[model samples]
Each structure stands twice: as C-alpha cells, then as structure tokens.
Target: MNIVSQEHQKSGQQPTEQVTYAAPYVDIEPAESGYVLRAEMPGVNRNGIQITVEDGNLVLVGQQQPLSVSGEALHRETRQLSYRRVYELDPSIDADRISARIDQGILTVNLQKAENLKPRRITLE
Candidate 1:
C-alpha cells in the first residue's frame, strides 16, 4: 500500500471538487485461522495500486481514470473517481506473512495470525 499523509481539511473550508471520487468498498472477515479483507476497486491496475503496512496499520491506495468518450458527444454524464482506505491492524496479525491479490475487480488481503495468537493444545500434568 502506498503511504500518504492524511490531508486535514480546515473547518468551514469549502469541499474540493476532487472528493467526488468513488470510495472503495471493503469487507473484513474472521476465519478459523486468520482474517480476510476484500476490497472492491474496479478500473484499477496493478501499477495503479499500492498496499503497505506500517506501525501496525494497513494502508491501501489506488487511482482510477474516468471513462473517456470522444466524437459527436450529445450527452455525457459519468465522473472519474479514486480513493484510499487505511486500517489499523491488530497485534494478532502476522504482518510479515500478509499477502494480497487482485482478481475480478476485487482486492483480497489475507492477514495471517501471529504464531503466538494461534490456539495451542496443552497437556495436563
């Protein structure tokens, strides 16, 4: 994931036109062994996307180009969009083993469970 400093908008400041981009949808699920995070980021390529983990936080960034139409345009009404989402990862996640892949317009991130976080069977004395 790309690391970007958060832009703080001043209070009462007029919203910028660039904020109209579509926000990606994300779903987080807990499995028997780990956590799965799926994000919907259509119209984005591998080069346009970035994912990074820093200070126990997972960050996702990407850009999407708006559809272009040329020649004899009578009516056009689609806007271009892009977005970013940052998640504060829990300590139970094994950050070093995290993996991600994009398929069918969905970005899937798997957070492996830390060795210490996994359940262990103990024998009674």
Candidate 2:
C-alpha cells in the first residue's frame, strides 16, 4: 500500500492535519454460482477492515495499525494509512447470502446470485 501524508506547513502558517485514503487493488470475477471480489490491502489486518453492503453498494474500509518506533528511523518506507473502496452491486445478487473473509491482507467477498435469477434448464416431456 502506498501511503501519502498530507502535511501543509508554510513558513508562517500553522500546520493542518489532512486525512487521505488509498484504494486497494480489487479483482472481480464471475463464477457459475456467483461473483467473487478480491481486494489486496497490504498492511491491513482482519480486525482493521470493515465490509458492508448498503444501498446496493459494497463498501470496504480499512486502516493500518500505527507502528511504534522507539527511536528515529534512518529509513522510512511505510506509514499509517487508511483505505476505502466502494463497488456498486447488481440487483441480481443475493445480498443476504454474501460472505466475506480476509487472509494475509487479501480480502475476498463472495456475492451469491439470487436463486430465482440463476440460469436453469427445463425438461420438455
């Protein structure tokens, strides 16, 4: 995850705090029974991520835990960051049956298609 901190400090201006968010890379695939959404959010743990489906939109929110450094670091690469991503879901999906899980910074959301909307074959006797 690329974390960018917004620090506005001028010669005589007071520093202001700004919050920025990074969007995680996501992959969506269609399956025989449903759709799968996989998001890659490095530095984010399971407890730091939140997922919800609201108003036909799948919302993902995540925050990286802050690192406690005892002394000044010679080199710095990572930062405290937050993440957010939203995807508009189709009405054919069964929202109630949706499932989500996270493993090794990978978040997977399974959206099951509505039973009535699934393709089926009819036998003609």
Candidate 3:
C-alpha cells in the first residue's frame, strides 16, 4: 500500500503573494482490516476541516481561524495558514467506508478495505 502526496499551489490576490500549501506530517499504520492515518494539524478546529474522496484520491483540507488583533502587529510568523493535502488511494480501499475525526489537533482517518479484499476461510473438501 502506498500513499503519495502532491504539492498544490494556492492563488493569491497579488501575483507575488502566491502561497504554497504545507503538508502536515502524517503517520500511517497498517492493520489486518485496513490502515490508520494520523495527521498533525494544530490550531485547526473541527469545523475548519474538509475531507473528501474524489477520483481515487483522499483530500484533506484545513483552514486555520484567522488571528484577530486589535492593533497592527509589527511582525508575525504565520498570518493565516491553510492546509491542503492529497493522498492517492489504493484501489483496494473502499471509499464509502472511510471515516475521520479530529482530536487535540490530530486528525485520524480510518480506511477500510473492500469486502472482497478481506481474507476468507474455505472448507476442506
């Protein structure tokens, strides 16, 4: 099983302001039933995440809430960061059974194998 990440660019108002999305570090674990994916997404709320499956790919999007400041800031590291990561899903994975949840800035995605891909037992003839 292999999951590949592709870089994507986000259009900005100004041509010089083009921003490239940062892919969060992910941890994948294989299981007998399927695979478990864990992604680190700090400062992202539950409502800020969007998960979708399209064209044999799993897409993960997270929008960090913009920081509010009454006075003008002299300097800042990340003004408003957004996350966009896409993973190529294997054909054996059942997209319909996929589920995800976020807890303490950690996103967990459960990928279940297709019914036909599961191991079966055969009776002795």
User: Clashing residue pairs in candidate 2, if any?
Assistant: none
Clashes of each: 3, 0, 0
Q: Report the lDDT of model 1 for residue 97.
A: 91
Q: What tens digits encode model 1's per-residue C-alpha lDDT throughout 1-125?
A: 32333534634555554343455788999976788999988777676778899777888876775556667868755334565888999888888998888876688889889998788998999
Per-model RMSD to reference: 5.5, 7.1, 5.7
Model 2, 1-125: lDDT tens per residue?
54444324434556565668787888999977889989887778889988888888888888877766698889977545687787898999998998888888888889999999988998999
For all predicted structures, in order, the TM-scores are 0.71, 0.74, 0.74
Task: Mark the 10 consecutive residues where model 2 has the least summed lDDT.
Answer: 2-11
Give the worst 10-residue stretch by lDDT in candidate 1.
1-10
Question: What does candidate 3 score in Cα RMSD to the true structure?
Answer: 5.7
TM-score of 1: 0.71
Candidates in order have lDDT scores of 0.75, 0.80, 0.79
Model 3 regions more than 4 Å off: 1-20, 69-75
Model 3 per-residue lDDT tens digits across residues 44-70: 889999999988889988777776679
Indicate the residue-level lDDT of 70 in model 3: 92
TM-score preference between candidates 1 and 3, better one: 3
